[model samples]
Target: MTITIRSALMKNFLGDSPDWYKWVIISFLLLNPLVFFLVSPFVAGWLLVVQFIFTLAMALKCYPLQPGGLLAIEATLIGMTSPAHIGEEIANNLEVLLLLIFMVAGIYFMKQLLLFLFTKLLLSIRSKMLLSLAFCGAAAFLSAFLDALTVIAVVISVGTGFYAIYYNVVAKQADNNSQIADDSLIDNPEHQQIMEQFRSFLRSLLMHAGIGTALGGVMTMVGEPQNLIIAKNAGWGFVEFFLHMTPVTLPVFVCGLLVCLLVERFRLFDYGTKLPEPVREVLKEFDRKASAKRNRQDKVKLVIQALVGVWLVVALAFHLAEVGLIGLSVIILVTSFCGVTDEHDIGKAFQEALPFTALLTVFFTVVAIIIEQQLFSPVIQFVLQAPPSTQISLFYLFNGLLSSVSDNVFVGTVYINEARAALEQGLISLKQFEMLAVAINTGTNLPSVATPNGQAAFLFLLTSSLAPLLRISYGRMVWMALPYTLVLTLVGLLCVHYALVPVTEWLTQWNWISPPSLNVISSVTAH
Candidate 1:
């Protein structure tokens, strides 16, 4: 009886994960204290970070929140970090938390509009290459002015809605065929092949859009949360930020679209799957029925959503308020006008965003541990000691490598603060400081595309409900992003090394940037 109870408890610990994996997690927890006592808290803290990443990499097997949260709890108890430190980290990143909560749910109300637009595009475009380019381009445009995760939420909703419609049609056909013969719909090899092809097609388009977000998210202050932080520290306004980033981001943006086209044209990295004819017919019929059934009220709802989407863009462009607050306003406006007032309907919108919100807080806890242990201090010190001529390139490479494994926002914050300190102490010139700031922003933004672990947007997509349905796994996402990663990283490095200084000089000459003697750094680095 005792043995049976113990086995049951073990089984309940990681629910459905393999027992070997469960033991591994348990061993990690058990070994941390020993390492803390014998080796050092620094080594132990690094081990905990590695263990947490392991959970994230295995996200398909289990959601990382529960296991990762457990590790966070252990870290706090063992003095790697304190509860107060975690709370402080959360306070520092509260805007991101609110953005995850309200913006994602806000986009939920606009799915009908997104689906209708994408559906029309899908039916109108015959060339798969053009279609891929359109998805990637539109996603990039939207992500530049809005949140990347919110843009992805819209994309995922459209893809999932399409899949659900086709799935239901197939199910109905299978049910009807059961009454006629043994060759049912599910038993047909050709039908199965078509379904697989359809899945591949959606997977490619989704991956393209996901990469598009990264490409555009590096371009402007509003493109990412960390961009805002970097801009605040540098005292750059919207136009200044855009001009500074254009040297790197604009080139990468064009190259990214070209890569999208070339990959589809050559069928590289699982990209060239065409929509099967049968599935296309089903989608066409569905779209036709949807169009025919649309009434005056449906048209009004779509128009309202379109207007609100425009407002979202304008508000963000002007920096009207916090992005999260604007998202909240969008939610209130769209839902109140679109007849989504029911308690149940509103609750459903929160379902997708809330889980990811919880997971993000857990991530902050790990970031707190990193901060408490000074895990990245040595790298920052090494970069600061490099020759001034090569520091920009070195900072870019260092940031990219660390951001690939850790949170880009945290990496950007730490590096920028260090650079600001150096500037304040007169260790670096004002001109050099500006160049390094650009390097930090572009570095954290561009190269983190190598893995979902680095960017919150990628992680949100990987953990989304659409990922499992579309058959997009962690390894698959990494493989698909390889081309974009290489292109953006190399191009961005060259720009940082050569173009950054010249661009700053030109901007200063044109009276667009403040002169070096103005003490503008005091105002910009206030945060």
Candidate 2:
């Protein structure tokens, strides 16, 4: 009897331990998100808790936890896997989703408006190449200063809008069959209404604009992602940054133009319509509306131009003085408020950045941690060790391929850091490095619209804004991008080789005596 009683007690004790353990896990899960509000302590949740338990149980049951290289991964896994309050997990994930949504929305909305204006300008000017070149120049400059994504968003929007107006309003009025189609369609149509009126030729031209803007981004350190990473990692300043990247940018742009021209020939198949009369009518409308509304648009443009000019000056000053991005932003903001741009707009820009900034920073920080841990060092080093020419060539190829897998910005940031390391280590010089930057930057963008999974915010933005008027399709966009990609890659390759490579090779060869610290390890650590 005594033995039976003792057995019962033991069973109860064992069952109680599990109950207690589960309760404790539940408590931690609940408290995890709350920890973010607390500066003093670290708590984690999400499916993290569940994963942690599994990892711990498996590791303990199956193997030993070793210290060293894998420790960081182990820590991350553990923290991320640890059980958390389901509520907290949901909330955190929701925040991330919201951030991503905002980022996508901001870019799309901004691009639509910009595109509208560019189309207006094109209608007034009626020269696709001219518009394209101007756009490319602006894109290149902006990419060199602000981030490429932002520049692209703005430029693409303008391109889309400019043509939209010309086609939807301006082109239709002047077209040959347009009047009959409009009258018949409204009264009683026999055949489908032909909507082509604006410069259908310019449709292909808009494709070139994207190509040019993307190519231009490769020209300078500030132009795109990989370059920025390279600058920071390679300890490059402005003069050095541009000098190094020119090899890639120059060739890429030149070749890109040729390709764009060629590709545009195929785009000419879009022979849907010609210069319409309505485009001018619409411009007149815009002018009247704008003038009546205190001529806000014209005034805004003037202010925008001046602010941009000042922004550049202030940015350069900061760079020269090494005052950093903060100083530049302050200068831009102060000057932007000078009877031109509204303070509200400036604030909006900053606020707009906030949505994704923190999340992106965290992601990069984690990646950086991984690098510091040396787990990622091997892969990066392997890529760096490849010939600069090969790296430049392969960078575009791989970037284009992988762009279908992730966000262009994400790919860009990773590539930049990796390329920077290569530059610093002498695996690639600055010029060679820039060549790779250009290739990858352009590559990432074209493929972004390859599918829903790959589609970027810009793609959606374009569709939503213009679908009502132009009736472009998802399939059409993909098909359109195909010709774009083919021409762009070919032209981009040519441009990089022609413009940047020779100079880069010369510089690299001359600097050989100093023997660049080809190994990124030395720079990051005291070793």
Which of the numbered candidates is closest to the native, going by highest lDDT? 1
The runs of at least 3 residues in candidate 2 whose Cα sits more than 4 Å from the true structure, single-residue gaps closed, are 1-120, 127-206, 269-273, 288-314, 321-346, 365-396, 415-457, 460-464, 467-469, 491-502, 508-527
Residue-level lDDT for 82 in candidate 2: 26
Task: Spell out the clash pairs found in candidate 1.
Answer: none
Q: Estimate the TM-score for candidate 2.
A: 0.59
My TM-score estimates for the predictions, one after another, are: 0.87, 0.59
The candidate scoring highest on TM-score is 1
Q: Which regions of candidate 1 deviate over 4 angstroms?
A: 1-3, 164-184, 237-239, 406-410, 417-434, 455-473, 511-527
The residue-by-residue lDDT of candidate 1 on 1-527, one tens digit each, is: 45687888998998998888889889988998899889998899889878887887666577788888899998899899999988976786677677767877888898888778877877788889999999998888878877787778788877877776666676565324223222244466766677778889999988888888888888877677678667766766666777878777888888889889999999999999988788888889878888899999999999999999999888876778887788899999999999988999988878877877787788778877877897766766787688886988998888898788766766776677677667777778787777887899889988998998787778888877778767788889899989989998998898888888887788889987676545345644443
**Model 2 shows how many backbone clashes?**
49
Write candidate 2's Cα lDDT for 1-527 as tens digits: 35687667644542433554444444544554454245311223222223332322322122112111122244344443222332232232332233233322333223423444554555565544455555545555544554444655564445444444334442334434333323333322311232343434434444444444455555554444444444444445566666665555455556555554444334443522333444556656755665577556555644554554465545543464432343344335434443436556545544434544443433343344333334335556666667766666667666666555444554565565566555556666644555665566556654443432233333333444433334455555456556545655565455444554666567778872122345233433421
What is the lDDT for 156 in model 1? 80
CA lDDT, every model vs. true structure: 0.80, 0.46
